[model samples]
Every structure is written in structure tokens, then in C-alpha cells.
Target chain A: MDDPLMLARVQFALTAGTHFLFVALTLGLATLVALTQTRATLSGSAVAERMTRFWGQLYVINYAVGIVTGLVMEFQFGLNWSGMSRVVGEVIGAPLAMETVVAFFVESTFLGLWIFGWDRLNRWVHLGLIWVVAATAYFSAYFILVANGFLQRPVGFTMVDGQARLTDLGALLTNPTALLAFGHVVFGGLLTAGFFMAAVSGYHLFRRTAEADLFRRSMRTGLVAVVVSVMPVAAFGGMQYAYIQPTKHPGAQESAAQVAQFEARFGPGDYTPPGLATAGEVLMEVAWSLMFFLAFAMLVKLPFGRWLERGRVFHVLMMAALPLPYVAMISGWVFREVGRQPWMVYGVLKTEDALSDVGAGAVAVSFTVFTVLFAALVVVNVWLLARFARRGPEAVRLGAPGAPEPERPALTPTF
Target chain B: MQTLALVVLAVLTAGYLVLAGADIGMGMLLPVLGRDGRERRLVIAAFAPFFLANEVWLVAVAGVVAGAFPGLEHALLSGLFPVFVALVAGWVVRDAGLWLRGRVDAAAWRAVCDGAIVAGSWALALSWGAVLGTVLVGGSRVEDGVNAGTVLGLPLALVFAAHGAGFARWRLASGLAERARRVPGRYWVSGAALAALPVAAGARLPWSQVVSSPEALAVTAVMCVLMVPLLAAAQALVWWTFRGRAESPGYL
Candidate 1:
């Protein structure tokens, strides 16, 4: 019973972290496809047309996986944190309401159309629908993020009868962390999408199927998107850092006043949690800055512009940059969450106060199960992705002009 | 204060169903809305493919009630067992019929399954609205000191269902959205009147809750006031997005 909060936190953390992989990639790639496909229509490139179908397929894969994993987090809030809900549910419920009513439905409607409208609907309108769908995906993430930011640094609510109740709708809407968090998160999405695009294009380049032009263009789109997205992301990361630096929640800032409290409890060898308390954050900030440059460099994968020659080095660099955003974002997230430390929902509840009744063994078992499952997904995703990568814009290339049409793989010849 | 909180909770709870419930109901109605027997069969074929996934919310809510408000849980779930029975019956029968319809692909079996889905959807919508209605209208004659209403015009029940049906139509297909747009005036009329009742109830409040905690009351009032215009805007947005080109798949 006492450990319920702990269990919930751990579970939510794991689920959120895992699901984010899908979301970041989805947001990044979905919009890119829309933009690129629109470019294709106007530019009249068969490669760009095939590119849309290519990236759109990956988006579908990511979105389907995300839809399942994301559901757990929503349910866990009610299942695990009912105590919090009864209190701030009025305001807390608003974004969630909008998410279901507007953001989610909008995304679903267009997503359904985009996926099934391959040959259906007018091309530009079809493009418009996909764009709307992509926008809604980001919009959905923003509202959920705002709700989370509120939890991290609650505002616009007043305490009545010893429980906090919402007192300002506008305040909740403009919660200081909202914009910053969204900026940081949406940029991360672009990085994920860019990496996915780069990897597939890299695969095609390696297999020597319809090379140079398509792969280089894909690298340009992937890299440029990441580079452009970095501006808002870096700005947001800074803002989020500032927001979490203070502690107004009832003596939450023990480090400021009582060196003794730290010394007393974590005394003998307790220099650890404090001395380098912000190390992860500092490193993450540096990492993000470096990745921003790497993304820009990746844009030179095009012929003779020379960020690097179109080969192994460029591919490796792009792949390396791909994981940088992943690391930087996750580290920054960790810094924020752990930095908040003692408080669960700031100013209202203490983290230690909320552990469930479960025991260490149970926690260990469930943790093991979740980790194994997540790892299996990663493995399966990689292998499956590799197979699809080999298939590369090749099938569509069979009909493209001036191209030595791709030969089907030997393994699955129509026997 | 408790009454106001309850009222807010009732509204939130009702909205939860009206919005997400359509997702569930339409999934159930998937097979039935098929073009011919074949397309309908195919539609039903993939319908509710991962249903347990979507139903997680209902379970989550129950867990919340049990964990957070143990007192409320017993009073509510136990006392409302009959209505609970009907709600569960609907969820289960619809689910089973969906599966059975697949296995027993005969037209009769398919008809039975589709009928069950529609009936279950009606029951699910009504039970949810009934619960909201009882909370608002204070239930009919309080047996065992628990409010249990028969669920007719009780406060906001009909309006909520109308809202649910509207959601159902919008979620299904453009054809359904068109059909919903053409739904009888009474449906929208009832919805408007029911939606208005809370504002009416709210206006007469001794202003006590407001006066006691002006700030909180102000926020609550703001939330309530916003609901009207916000809902109107959302409906308008939905219509605007899909208004033109009925023949095409308007993903506006």
C-alpha cells in the first residue's frame, strides 16, 4: 500500500520512456513526409513521390507501436494516481479532455485517410490531410506535456480543505514550462525522424539500389530538419532548466539551508547526490549543442557541397548524430525529474509519501519483465527495420524512368 | 462544496464517455455499417482488433475509485450494481457478439452480432448518462439512501446520449457524419436543453460556494462558462473541417 506511489512512478517512467521512442520519431517523420511530398508534387520528382511512400510507411509502423504503448500511461494515471486526481482533476482534466476531443481525433481522422488514401483523394488535399495529421500529433504531445509540466511545477491551483483545487484556467494554460517543454520535445522528434530517414537511405546506399540522388536528398531532408529544429529545442532546454532550479515547496531546498541535513542523512559518504548534482544536465546541454552542429554537417551529404563525401564516414556521422539527440533528450529529462527529487507533484505531495504496498521482490520481477520486453522490442524493431530497409524505395523504383529498375531480392523469388 | 465537486465530477465523467465511448461504440458497430455484406464483414473483421486496449480506461477509473475513494467506490459500484450489470452486460455482450459474429459468419449470426452491438451501445450510453442524471437530479426516491434513477430526462442524461450519438456519427464515416448532421431536431434540441440545465442550476447556487472561496469559485465558473462556447467551437471546427466535398474522404 505504501509502495503504490513508488510502483506507479517506476512503471510510468518506464512506459513513458519507452513510448517516447515511437512518438519522437512519429512527429519528426510524419511532418517531414508531408512537407517532402508536397515538394514532390510541385517539383515533379518521381524519387520524391516514392520518398513520401517510403517515409509514410515508416511513420505508420512507428505510430502503430506508439498507439499501444501510449495507452498504458493514460490508464496508469487513473489506476495509480487516483489520489492526485480527486484533488486537481478539474484543471488537470482539461488538457486530457482536449487531447481526446480535439488532438487525438483529429490525428486519427487524417491518419486513417493518409494511410488508406494511397490512390484515393486529390493529391494536394491528401497532402493537406497528412499535414493536419502531423500537426495534430505534435498538438497531442503538447497538451500531455503541459499536464506533465504542471505536475512537475504545479500552478494555478489553490488549497482548500487541505487539498489543492484549480483556481486559474489561464494560469494552467500558460504554465511557464509549457512552451519550453514543447520546444525541446518537438525538436527531439525531428532528430528521431531524421535518424530513421538517414538509416533507411543509408541502407539503400549500401545495397547499391538507385543511389546518389535519392539517398543524398533524404540525407539533406533528414539533416536540415534536425538542424532547423535545434533552435527551439536549445532554447526550451534552457528554460526548463531555469524553471526547475528553485524550490518553493516547503523546505524542499534542503541543500540551501541545511548542509547538516545532507550531512546528517547522507552524511558520511553522502557527497554524491549533491556535489555533481547538475553534472548530467551540464553534459546534456553540451551534447545537444554538439549534435546541432553534427546535424548541420549531415546536410552536406549532398554531392560536392561536402559535409562529407557520400560514403561510410557520412553514414556513420549521421547515425552517430542520430543517437545524440536521443541521449541528450533522455539525459535532460532525467536531470529534470531527478533534480525535482523529493517532490512528486511539487508543493503538494512528497515522493516518499507515495510508495505502493508492493515489496522489493515484486518490483524487481516487474522491472525485469518490463526491461526484457522493451529490449525485445528494440531488437525486433532493428531486425524488422533492417529487412524493410533492404526493400528500400526499390519496389516503387521498378517503374521509375532512367533508373536501372531494382531487382527483387533473391531470397523471396516467386517460386 | 461536496455537491459542487460531485457535479463537476459528474460532468467530467459524462464527457469521458461521450467522447471516448463513441470510439468504443463505433468499433462495435463496425461490422454493421459495412457497405454490402462483404465490406461490412471486412469492416467488422478488423473491428475492435485491440479492444482490450481501448477499454483500459474504464478499468482505470474503477481502480481510481477503489484506490482513491474507497468510500465512494462501495457506495457507488455496489449500490449501482444493477446499472453496473447493464453496463457490463452491454460491454460483454457487444464484445462477445463481435467475436461470435466473426466465427459464425452466417448472415443471421452477423445480424445478431450487429444488433447486440447497437443495443449494447445504447445501453452503455444510457447507463453512463443515467449515472450522470442521478447525480444531477438526485436520483428517483433514494432507496437505501442511494440515488437510483430510471434514467429518462433526469437532468443531463438524454443530452449526454445525444452528444454520444453525435460523436458516434462523426467517428464512423463521412456518411454517418452527414446522417448525424441530419438527425432530428429533437436530438439536438434535447442536447441543447440538457446542456443548459447545469448553467441554470449553477446560476441559482446560493453563491455560497462562490462567496466562500471567490477564487476557486471564479475558476469553476470560468471552466463552466468556457464549456459552452468551447463545445460550440469544437462542433463548429468539426463541421468546418469536413463541410465541403461530401463524396471525397474529407479528413478535415
Candidate 2:
């Protein structure tokens, strides 16, 4: 752990893992809230309006933390892995710079308008702001994956005077690895958000809270979202397995050829991923399969989720399942990142070569500081989320300009 | 084109420093100016919206640096790795604290968040100043390598603190405003006096060979000199435009 290389890897794993938790939620919830508000605008239903505010409130909570965590993620490139930055700064940094100049500004600016412009803007304009936020969020994710894709499988770049330079911008954006990875991540994000809403609403309805009608409706929406999203999520994961797996573990004959080639080019580095990463990949697949089955069961067996509406065991199950998708997502990320070890930019810059000329003590100290700070942040994030979630939607301040006053309670205590 | 890019980058950096300084000042002033939690909230709310917008300049500056001068950025960031990490951490913690403060109702939790804000703000101010000191003293010349603390560190921090206090003085009102006004008077004078160290240090370098274009350097220097009065005018205009007593709106 004291070794700078190991410490740096640990730091990246901790920061990226923690950062992904927030990102997954932000990506998924942003889409869901947009859907709720869009539906509310079209049908003008009171329940839909309440749904928007309630979930939107939670979305804001998650998004605020996500933005900060992301800032830290961006800095680590320069601070921890200066070698990677210097080698690929011309190529990878292009997308990141674009992410800031184009995607971030759009999402952040519109999000502000959508948040504070509640009473100021026209309703349609307000709705548009959210869609912009959602679009830009996904767009930002795309450019980021484009950069990451290059790392997974280097493309459209040439070594010029000891630096990787962009030779074809089009190929970089159109890289198959990045597109597949983007699909897997985006759909996975939706799945995470869907299950989260279902589980939270399930908890409320199970307790027979005063907002049963609202919770029941919310649970149904979540269930639908889960059912819809699981297909694309599975499809994309399958696509990745087919595309990325063989490259990692080539057939015995090809493996020999590849190893010899790699050794000739860049001597004495392990090209193979650790055995545990394969196990994690398997765990991710197994967990995703289970999620699919659960979604199907909820949709068909429950029939409008009426069965799940009242059963104590079912609510407990839903609540229990909340952390599973998160687990799967994290395992999948770990597998992906760790799979490409030894090379920070796969075949170009070795991880050892990419490190800054800093002392081991410096890396260790920074790692400790970041870990403690991140842990504290996660605690605050989870506490606020749980507290607000249990409080129900009435606790949501619903009186923004165009927002309607509270309707008479629709929830009847059926239990 | 390279010179032009460098000049643009310099302006962007200056923009971030001035804008973000005031924002950090708001957080730093929380413990100092706020008599209680309510007053603290008022101080935070006074600049929270603007803080988010001001922070964008940070992202933009970084983006421009990476895009425009990849080599320089590489050397600077790697050479100053420890400080960069600390600065990044400071930014993360500060953002979390400020945003999270308004979300909860618990007194203990609020206090924790406030502590995060104070610590983060101070770290950012100090680290940023230290970076300036490093650059001003010449990147490779400092004796302690990457870990060496620069002479400009304290002065830069003080100058930024003064900038923040000035913003708060103009933007906030009553007790908070009065306290904020005193911060610059306390720190800015000394900071200004100490600012000569970096200039004198930089004079030791072969100044003519610093960049390829002497005109660009001359223009930048003139711009740098012009910034002080320009910043003063800009702040004065903003204060007058939003002037009067500082009152926290119920919504913000």
C-alpha cells in the first residue's frame, strides 16, 4: 500500500468508485424527473406534478454532490497520474476540454435555470431546460466515454515527437469500444434510477405511510422504468462481452502470438487481467440477470404491482434490492478499469512511466486526505437522501410559481 | 496564435482568481462574521448562486490550459503534484459543504458542514497563493523541489482574502457587511506591501527569453498592471448596481 503505484491505483479506484455512485444516480434520476415533468405538462395531472417535485428534490440532492465529486475526478489526472496527462493530453484532453466548454456549461446553466427559474420562466421553457440538462448530461457522458474508449483500445492517434496526437477526430468519436461502453453505462444508469425509485416508494407503501396512493403510483412508474431499461442494459452488456472479452483472453494460440508481440514492443508487463476481475465480471453478469428476472416478476406476477403494494416481505425485498444494482454497477466499473492495468494508455504509456516524480509519502498522504474527505461526503449524501426520502413528498416545497398548491390527499389508507 | 492563446489563458486565469476569491471569501467569512447560524445562512445565501456561476470560470480555465498549453500544463501540474491534490480536495470539500448546508435541518449537521466550508475555503485560498508563489519564483528554481513552500504563498492568500472580504462588504449588509469591510483593511495593505517579493524574484530571470514574443509579454504585463483598477471599478459597479442593505431573500 505504501508503494506509489499501488497507492495511486487505490486512490483512483476510491475516487472513481465513489464518483460513479453519484454519477449513476444523476444520470438515471435526471431522465426520470424529465419524464415526470413532461408527462405533467402534457396531461396537467396533479399527481404527476407532485411526482416531479418530490423526485426532483431528491435529484437535486444527488446532483449537487455529483458535481463536486466529478471536480475531484478531473483533478486526479494532473495530480496523481501526470504521465497519462502528458502523453495523452493532446488526444484525451480534447474531449474533456469539450466536455467543459460545451457539455458542462449547457447542463449546469440549464439546471440552474430549471431549479431557480421555477417561477420565472414559461412552463414549456422550464420543461425544455430539464430536457437540455438530460441531453447534455448524456452528451457529457459520451465525450467522457470517448476519452475512456481510447484508453481501452487506442484509436485514431499517432505518436509524434514522444506524444500521442490526434490524427482523426472522427474515428475517435466513432470508436466502437466507446459507443458500446456508452450504451452500457447510459442504460445501466437508467436501471439504477428506476430501481431506486421503486425501492424508496416500496418502503413508504409497505409502511402504509399516508402517501400510499402517491407511493403506489410511484412504485408502478419505477417498475415500468426498470422493465423498460433492463432490456437495453442487458443488450449493451452482452455487446461489450462479445467485443471486449476475446481481446482480453485470446485463444491459446492467439494468446501466445499476442504475448510475444507485446513483449517485443513493451517488455515484461502483464497483459492479462487478474483472476478476481474475471470473477467480478461474472458477478456483474449474474447480478444483472437476477435484476432482469425480478423486473419481469414484478411486471407479470404482480399485475400492476398490486401484490407488491401490500406484502411486507415484498417491500423488504424491494428495499433490500436497492443496493444490488449499485453493487453490480461498481463491480462492472472495477472490472473494466482493472482489466487494463500496467498500461495507463494501453500499448502506449506504461503506468510506471506515467507517474509523477513524487515521493511515495506524498502519494500516500494525498490518498489518505482524499479517502477521508470522500467518505465524509458519501456519509452526508446518504444521510440526506435517506432522511428526505422517508419524509415523503409533502415535505417537498411545492409552491414554485407555476407549481400547483397541494391537492386534497389522494392516498386512501387501504391497509 | 500560440502567443494569443497564452494571453487568453492568462486573462482566464485572472478572471477565475478574482471571481473565485470573492466566493471563497464568503465561505471564509462565515465563522468570522456570522454571530449565529441564521447569520451564517444569510452570509452563505448572499453569494451562493453567484458562487456556482463563478466556479465555471475554474473549469473553463483548466480546459483552456489543457487545450492551449499542454506542455506547460503538464510540467506545472506534475512539478506541483502535492499542492494540486490539496487544491482539488479543497475545492471538492468546499462545494460539498456549501451545497449540503441548506439541505438539512439539524444543528449538529449544519455545524459540520460549516466546518467543511471553512477548512476547504482556507485550503483553496492558501494553495492557490502558493502556486502563484511557485510560478513567480520560477518553476525549477525553488530549492525544496515539489514540496517547497514559496515566498508568495501568504501574501497571495491574504490578497485573495482581501478580495473576498471586499466582495462581501459590498454584497452583504449590517453586521456581516461591517465585519467584511474590515478584512481587507487588516490584510490587503500588508499583502500589497509583500507583493514586491515575487516581482523582485522574477527580475533575477532572463526576462527577455521567457516567451518568444516580447510584444505578448509587454502586452500581458500592461494588462496585468491595468487589472487592479479595472477590478476595483468592476466591484464598485456591481456594488452600486445591487447596492443598499444586504438581505437574504426567503427563497435563495
Candidate 3:
């Protein structure tokens, strides 16, 4: 905790991690919106398009905030972890660079066109731009994931003069951990979006505010998205990730060996073994297992989720399950990064080498400030979205026959 | 293997040039592309929505360079410290220009914003050129690693300008073509000089060791050849895509 490097690590971890939840939600929800909207258009159902636009609008707002949070992340490299950049800047820098060029550019460009171009350009063409935007988001995520994967299990590299050289670009590109991590991350986003979408649709159902068909359709789509996307990761992703972070399993062995050495120094009866390390790993494993089981249980109820519409069991239960995935995600990231402890860029430069000489007070201070700001953002985003959501698409459009009507004539605003 | 990996880096760098270069060029050439205030606004609008994400390429390129070739990353960051600082500062200022669009009605403010961003873009583009010049012309006298080239005062600056101009031509191909048509020769000269620079030990690009060992050189050679025509074609494509008075889409 006293180490500048340690403080920097925790500071960035707290900030990056808190913001990560928002990003994943946007990534998954936006895609789901795109898919639903596309289906609506193809099927000549304006209901679907409205559903798409509705969820998409909320997602884009969340995305805008996420993007700002992400930009702040870049600055942290220059400010907090300049040492890491100095050492492995050549190798990891390329992907970060390319993500800016290829992925970020493509996403932002098309997203603009998608947002501002709506109705001004061809409808299908606008949709295409969103597809580009969504793809680019995932692409950006991929580059970062690959870089992290290298940190976990550095392959195709060599050390020279206390620094790491990326001797093997192929190995970095094809690391198995990178792929699994990417899948796990993307699917988790989809699941978050699913729950949010389902909840919104359910809210509409309870209020009797919008057309029942549209709300029902949204519910169905969100349920299917959640059930299908979450199942693979819950059932398989955990196992795959567990393997990659071998640190999660071998702590027991390490502690046992340490105890044995201690016993050799003294009589067995004279000394007791402290099994703290094993306890930690076992706790992590149990948490992960419990999360998996919970996800599985929710998914199992999907076929019959429609039946529980009166009770709204599925939406309530899934939202309850959100924290599980988040916990696992944070655990997975910690297990992966910390699991490969002692090395910032495996085997090339130890974490000890790349730490800056910053004080812990600075880290703790910044962490507290950002935590407040992020908490505020979360509250505002949720509140804004909820307020907007309460006014269904139909409420803004046509009112019920007996309900109060607008003062002005009903005319769609021309672009 | 170092030689092979260096080649991969070169390719990645070239990719960076193609993508990010285009983006920066677009940002800088907005003034030149638009004939009037309204047109300029449209131009800014066109590129504005994408600037931050567009800059992500710089991040990725830096990540790879930092991670893959730590030695080069170190020496280069130190050598190009001024350029790196300027590049980042430029990025920040350019963002200021776009984000400030709603707050300012003063023609002076708009003019200043545009000028700062365009100047920043030019500086960023040239910085990369200097980097390429250094990579091409100089080498480290090391035993078993990739060697970086020296960055001379004059030739490096000129070559950097040439890289900036070439990228601008490609990015603003629609309206600003003739202003930069003379850059290909300068580019070819820079490329040749860069190619001829001496190295104590040979370096490899990413794909060269496996497929492009000797027989594979042809593909890269041909790829370089295609670059010229592709560059020329890009200009035509730019005009074809944006030749109209302006198309105002609603959302981004």
C-alpha cells in the first residue's frame, strides 16, 4: 500500500474497473438493439424499429459517458503508469495505436452518421453505420484484450537488458487466453443489456402505457438474447478463464511448500502452518462457481419466463443476478492480472521494474474523487434513463382513445 | 527473427499511416476543403464525430512499439520527446476545437480553433515522418536487437513534411488535390533514402521471415508498388464520395 506502484495499480484498477461496467452494458445492449431493429424493419414491423430506437437511444447516451471515461483512461498511462509505457511501449503501443486508427475511427465515424444521419439518409444505410459502430466497439475491446492477454502469459518474447522485446507477434495475436477473455467479456455485455431491456419492457407492461405487442416483443427479444448469450460463458467461460489464471489454483501448493520449509526449521509440534493463500483461492473459486450456478438457473427459467409475466419473475431475478457477473468479471480481471503477479509484462520486466515513484496519498485522493464522480454518473445515467423510459415510445406518439391528447396537431417532425 | 519482426512493425506502422494519417489529414484540411463558413462547419461535422476514436490508432501503434520493441520505444520516445508532447497536446487542443463548437459564436474563436487543430495535425503528421526518417536513415550499434536510425535536422524535417502532405492528399482528396500533387516524388525519394539507410544488423518486418523470406519479398515489393496507384485512386474516390455541395445526415 505504501509503494507508489502499488497505489497506482489500485488507483487505476478502481477507476478503470468502475467505469468498465457501463462500457460492457453499452456494448451488449447496442448490439441487441441493432439486431431487434433490423428484424423489425425486415418484417415491416414499426414496433420492432421503435423498440430498437428506444433501447438504442438509452444505450447511446450511456455509451457517450463511457467514451469519456475511456478517454480519461488514456491519460492515466501518461500520468500514473508512465513507467510501464516506457518499458513495453513498443509492443503494446501498436494495438492501442491501431485501436485508435482502425477501430475507434470506424466506430465514431459511423456512429455519428448513425445518430445524426437518422432519417436524413437512407434508413438501411443508417442501420449499416450502426453495424459499423458496434463492430468497431468490439474491435477496440479486442485490441485491449490481446494486450492484457500478453501481460497474463507473455509468449513469443525475450528479455534484453531488463526490458521485454516482442520477438513473436504471432504468439501475441493467437494467445488462447485473449480469445477466451474477449468472448467472456462480450457475452457479459450482452447479458447486462438483456436484463436492462427486459426490465424496461416489463415496466411498460405493468403500466399499460404502450402497445402490448411492442412491449411483449421487446421482452421476448431481451429474454432470448440473455438466455443464449449468457449460457456459454456461465457453463464454459468460467472453466476456460480458471485455466488461464493458474495462480488461482497453485496458491495452495505454494503455501504448503512454505509451511513444509518452516516445519523443517522447527519441530512439527512447535509450529503451525498458516494456510491463508489456499483460503483465498478457494474463496475465489466458490464465488465464481456460485455465479455460474445462478446464471444457469435464470437461463433455465427462460422457456417458462413468459409464463411468469404476471409476477415479472424473470426481470426481477435477472437484475438480481447482474452483480454476480460483475463480481466474477472483477475477480477474473484481478485473478488474471494479479495472478500473474510480480511481472508487469511476463518474464520481460517485473512489475517492480516499471513502477513510478508516486506517493499513496495521491492515489487514494484521486481514487476517492473519481469514485464519487463515477457514482454520480451512475445515478444520473440511471435516473435519466428511467425518466425517459417511463415515457414509452407510444406515450410520446399517439395516446389512448380515452386518455388526454396533445394540444398541438400530431405531426412527425421533418428532419 | 529480429529482422522479421521489424518488418511486421514496418507494416503495422504503414497501416497506422494509412488509417490515422487519413484521419489527421481530414481534420487539418477542413479549412482547405470548405469554401465558406457553412461548408467548413459541415466539414468539421463530418470528421468531428469520429476524432477521438480515430485517434485510437495512435494509441495502438504506441502500445505495439512500446511492447514489442522496448529498446526502440525507449530511444525513440526520448529522441522524439518534443514531438510526442506536441502530438498529445495537439490531440487535446483539436478536441477542444470540436467540443467548443456550441459555445462560441465569435468568428475569431472559430478561426482560432480551426487554426490550432490544423496546425496540430500538421505537427503530428510531421512527427511520424521524422520517426520514419530516423528508422530509415540511422541504426543503433547494438549486438542482438532491432536498431533505430538517426533523425537528422534537415532531411528528417523535410521528409516529415512530405509524409504530412501525402497523408493530407489522401485524406482531403475531394477538394485539396492539386495543392499536394507534387508529394509522390518526395515520398518516393524519402522511401528510397529510408530503404538505403545502413544497419549494423538486418531487421525483419512482421510477415517477411515466414512467407516473404525471399520468394515472399515479391508480395511486399508489389504491395509497395500498388501503394502509389492506390494512393492516386484514393483521391478519385474522395471526390466521388464527397463532390456534392454537401449531404447533411441527421445524427452523428
Predicted model with the maximum TM-score: 2
Q: Which whole-number lDDT from 0 to 100 does residue B91 have in model 1?
A: 56
The sequence of per-residue lDDT tens digits that candidate 3 reaches over residues A192-239 is: 676677677767766566457777777777777767776665554665
Ranking by DockQ: 2, 3, 1
lDDT, candidate 2, A203-317, per-residue tens = 8988898988778878887878788889898788778765463335534465567667788987766776666676678888888888988887777744655665787776877
Model 2 chain A, poorest ten-residue lDDT window? A404-413
Model 1 docking grade: incorrect
Worst 10 residues of 1 chain B by lDDT: B243-252
Residue-level error in angstroms, candidate 2, position A125: 3.8
Model 3, backbone clash pairs (residues 3+ apart or across chains), number: 61
lDDT by residue (tens digit), candidate 1, A230-281: 7777777767756764532223554444434444654342222332236667
TM-score of 2: 0.85
Q: Evaluate every candidate with DockQ and list the scores.
A: 0.06, 0.22, 0.14
lDDT of 1 by residue, B31-59 (tens): 33443444343333232322332343343
Q: Kindly list the interface RMSD, in angstroms, of each predicted candidate in the order they appear.
A: 12.1, 9.7, 10.5
